[model samples]
Target: MTDRTPGFATLAVHAGAQPDPTTGARATPIYQTTSFVFNDADHAASLFGLQAFGNIYTRITNPTTSVLEERVAALEGGTAALATASGHAAQLVVMQQLLMPGDEFIAARKLYGGSINQFTHAFKSFGWNVVWADPDDIGSFQRAVTPKTKAIFIESIANPAGSITDIEAIAEVARNAGVPLIVDNTLATPYLIRPIDHGADIVVHSLTKFLGGHGNSLGGIIVDAGTFDWSKDGKYPMLSEPRPEYHGLKLQETFGNFSFAIACRVLGLRDLGPALSPFNAFLLMTGIETLPLRMQKHCENAKAIAEFLSTHKAVSAVNYSGLASSKYNALARKYAPKGAGAVFTFSLKGGYQAGVDLVSNLKLFSHLANVGDTRSLVIHPASTTHSQLDDAQKTAAGAAPDMVRVSIGIEDKEDLIADLDEALGG
Candidate 1:
């Protein structure tokens, strides 16, 4: 290869990887062991003290997981990244790193149902309060800020709802507030949009979805843009202040730009103990190698399905940003021009009963709670994923009772449209 930087597909396959140094194996080998042997007493001390970077325990880091982290970081245009057991685990680690007890964070109301539950309930137990804002109203985010606000969170392409958030606008709000903007780019994936390029300070992903395209592995990642100055406001004690665990060393001063990623790995991952297994890391890496190809097909099929649903008499509305009629269509063009992503929500004129009948009648679409799979999947969010929330909360989350979510897959577009047409009583 020439000095020219590799393209997305090339980097997806080769970034952060080389033939096995010891065995010369072409594929990434799984370092399945639980511990790594240090060279000597000083080496062991250096590893423990954060003075050196090498594997010590599988719980914090592993050779296989490191490759996955580096690949994801490069894909997202981030300085560094951390891999975790699941997407929720990744969120927990990042929140723990930035938030102290009694602190608050602002998040867009439209997000994954599981995330809403995690932020609203589980985080509250830790004294971390979530202030919700409407993504459709930029001023809502502005009004939600407080002196205790630590960060802002939003999904690039929100799950189920298929809304495209105005990431740059929110980044400005966070910038003016002296807080970082953390975007979960799970649905859009790096193949479609890179949040950091639009002024986001950090990006997170549930690699279990599109990144692991086959849906065979569970994983999540946090990518540090390395742009935020943790020491500027003195608000983030976890990074700005001295740490007794590492001999009173200040993380921001030592690690500079990538300090936040390091802090998540050493402090949060170490204590939290949610480690991604090496075998799963290997599977995710393989899936990523074909992400570009798979995402293209997924988007093409979803656009066709969305268009089909819009014209049908029985359909009340389609929430896909790819559709010209969608309120988020303009935002989708600005943020993700290639396509508006595959996961989207639509409602039937028959209301709740219609949604239940449509899902049950669809023979081709597998009814499931998951999205970003290689095969088409469907779910009634109000009855399943958002079941824990009350009616008001469900409506706020875009999971209205009449709505049905479909994660269009890499299947032939004609077949997908045909199946939906038949299911809709064509």
Candidate 2:
């Protein structure tokens, strides 16, 4: 290795990983176990107290998951990260650190359907309120903010719609409100957009999607940008206050820049117990190695297909940021000039029933609710993912009755287009 910083591709393959010490294995080996045997009593005590960083239990941490966390942190350019069982778990851990009962967080309305459901319903059960804001209008975020606002959440590239967000603009609102900005970079991935590079204090991902590349593993991560001043206004007590569990140690005072990650691990993950499996972590890490290669192909295939859909007679609209006519194209060029990403929605002239029929007719594209698989996938969001939302809510989330979303894979562009053509023709 040279003195110069490693490029994105190099980081994808080599960051946070090396030959196994036990067998000199080139690839990272899964440390699949429930607990670790400390060398001495003091060693175990130090680990349990967070005095030293070492594995104690799989529920809190594991060597395999640690590598995944470190690799994701390096890719996202965050100071530290925590791996979770799933993306929703990542959000839960993050919000747990920032919000108390009856507190609030501002969220962009344009988000993944699963996230919308989790924020609106699941968080409400915990007394954590969600204030919905329009990502298209930055002023909405500012107006939604109140004294109780703990954080602001937005997707880097919104799901289904593939629209670009004004992260810097909304980040300003968070800064003025003295709240951290949380950006879900699952759709864009770090390969396309590093939200931390553009004023994001925290970045979250559903590794089930592109990061895992294949539909083989389910995982999530929370990355601490190490830029937020959690102690400045004392808004986040989880970080700023003393902890009885760790013998009254103040996390922010103790861990400094990466305190947020530590808090999520010690307080949230340790108790909530949404631990990622070591085998899943191993698979996800392997998927990340070829992220640079897979992501580029995903983007290229997506842009071509979006172009094809734009011209199809059955299509009323194509909601892809890569398309020049899209409302988010200018922002895309500014934020993600590399490519727009793979998952995008298009409206059919035939509306709701047509959407269902398209998915039914498609031969190559599998009909599924999930996205970011190596195989092309299709879904009628209004009927499946966004079914819980009402008409107005569905429209707001960009999952209109007429919309059909597709996650373009690394397969041949012509084949994908032909499949879409045949489906629409039927």
Point to the candidate with the largest lDDT.
2
Candidate 2: where is the Cα deviation over 4 Å?
387-397
Q: How accurate is candidate 1 locally (lDDT)?
A: 0.92
Q: State the displacement of the C-alpha of residue 215, model 1, in Å, after optimal TM-score superposition.
A: 1.5
lDDT of 2 at 352: 90
Please give each candidate's TM-score.
Answer: 0.97, 0.97
Candidate 2 lDDT over 363-400, as tens digits, reads 99999888999999998989987788898987866778
RMSD of each: 1.5, 1.4
Q: What TM-score should be assigned to candidate 1? A: 0.97
Tell me the whole-model lDDT of each prediction, alpha carbons only: 0.92, 0.93
Q: For candidate 2, give the lDDT of residue 392.
A: 91
What is candidate 2's CA lDDT for residue 2?
A: 62
